[model samples]
Target: MPSYTYPVAAPNRTLTTEEIHILLTNTRVLARRLADLTQMRFVADYLLSGRFDATGGGIFYETGEEIFAADAPEAVAPGSEYPKTVLTAGELASARTVKWGIETDITDEKIAQQGQVVVDRALARLANTVIRHVDATAWGVIASKVTSTEASAAWTTPGAALEAIVRVQEERAALGTGLDLSTVVLAPAQYAKVLAMLVDADALPRNDSNPVLDGTLPLRAFGLEWVTSPHVTGTDPWLIDRAQLGGMADQTLGSPGYVSASGVGIETLSNRHKDDKYEVRARRVTVPVVTEPMAGVRITGTGL
Candidate 1:
């Protein structure tokens, strides 16, 4: 019973002013690095995906008319002049880029107790917000410009899910513009239901068995790459012709107009708030437009 008293644990100490400055600087750098990568199950970038740079805050697009030939190529006689063709150019249109942003504050006391780990977590939340905002905004444009809607059998129906897509493909083919619907964005609930049906029907086979799919980042079936998002507000899945859907314009990083995967621009700013806290401001400057509304279609009646 004569054991020595246990040593008291060292108490945590508050970080110094200089230490806080260093922390803020590191966080800013982290934000810059995060900017290079942004693509994450976001349907906006995949659907309205003609990513390009804006010269003067506005993107000029052609609402091109889908011109179709009235007849097959006529066999031209050796000396006869080629048949004259008259064309009406598509009307010119423009969409302006609107800046979208979100921000948060990190208090000195919180960081003093929690360290930079908390700061990193907060930065992550900021990035997520920016990306999600881009998607939501893009979806808003799509919903507003939908050209057509088709009723679909619920995915639970063994053969109906695949058939619905085929029907849609047929409709697009009828447009005579070669609108190839290569991607589909599903509501989370519909996505889950489809995956279950695929497994039950042995379309998504087990690894041990002869795999029908490669188990890749983009889950594919029904002749299109499928993705799920919480932002896809309804049960209907959206089918899009990526090549002709529309375009998303963003502010250029430098002299070049190329934007990265996220179709977003992320900027992180930090400054000490009179020695009490640091504020981080993150933003994306971009706009989405359904320049070719007919290039996409929404499949409805998924639950039915």
Candidate 2:
């Protein structure tokens, strides 16, 4: 709603060992905050549905008429029988803001002296970049796929999944949406040979020690974040390693393909009763944290 920003900490000039400790304590909290904000952005932008090959845009929880859990009065206006409820829409308009309550310690003098300012700043930057990359990928996929905007879920064969990936690339090209799609979410088996193929094509890094493919390719780096549901079962779960998260953020996916008819329809549907059809909209929301990875740990000599 407000361009999605991370909470800012007030600046203080005082520097003490105890204050420094507090800053370090809050650093972890800020990292979690970054995660929370980025996760929200991911869900809002990337929820997928419909047939895998013929998938569509995702549906999000939006506001509309509300039926009270408890009922009392029926009508507030004269001659009105229908339940009166607040109708609303959009993430900014209806979604709850996620807050991470993080507080700093008062006794850490060194952290306070350093201000812990650098760490917080770095966390913010990282969060923004990760959220942006994820949003771009989600939109790229949606724009290229063939399906309905209201598509709830998707199921597809291996072949269709491959085709969908190709179509995604093409769609991006036509729409001037710049993205290189290399990694695709598919039934584990479907990706096995493809993984090998990627390796053979020199697209994937050569590594046998790490069972998980080095999805982080120079031309097409990949990092997988999975949602485990009862529907997705009996699968080899190893995809992307969380350790690789930092690297994947910078890599690009290789050339992709797309077809005009491949994606779901974007439309304005009229609700006759309401007498208006609202357009489904989209945007990439990012939350960023900027912090230094390593803070110098120096032992200061205080007269013992």
Among the numbered candidates, top lDDT falls to 1
- Candidate 2 residue 289 Cα shift, in angstroms, is 19
Best by TM-score: 1
- Cα lDDT tens digits, model 1, 74-128, are 7799999887665655678888888776778888788878775566567667777
Task: Tell me how many residue pairs clash in candidate 2.
Answer: 50
Please report, as a residue range, the 10-residue window in candidate 2 with the lowest summed lDDT: 290-299
**Candidate 2 ranges with C-alpha deviation above 4 Å:** 1-93, 103-162, 168-197, 205-304
lDDT of 2 at 100: 15
CA RMSD of all predictions:
10.4, 23.9
lDDT of each: 0.67, 0.29
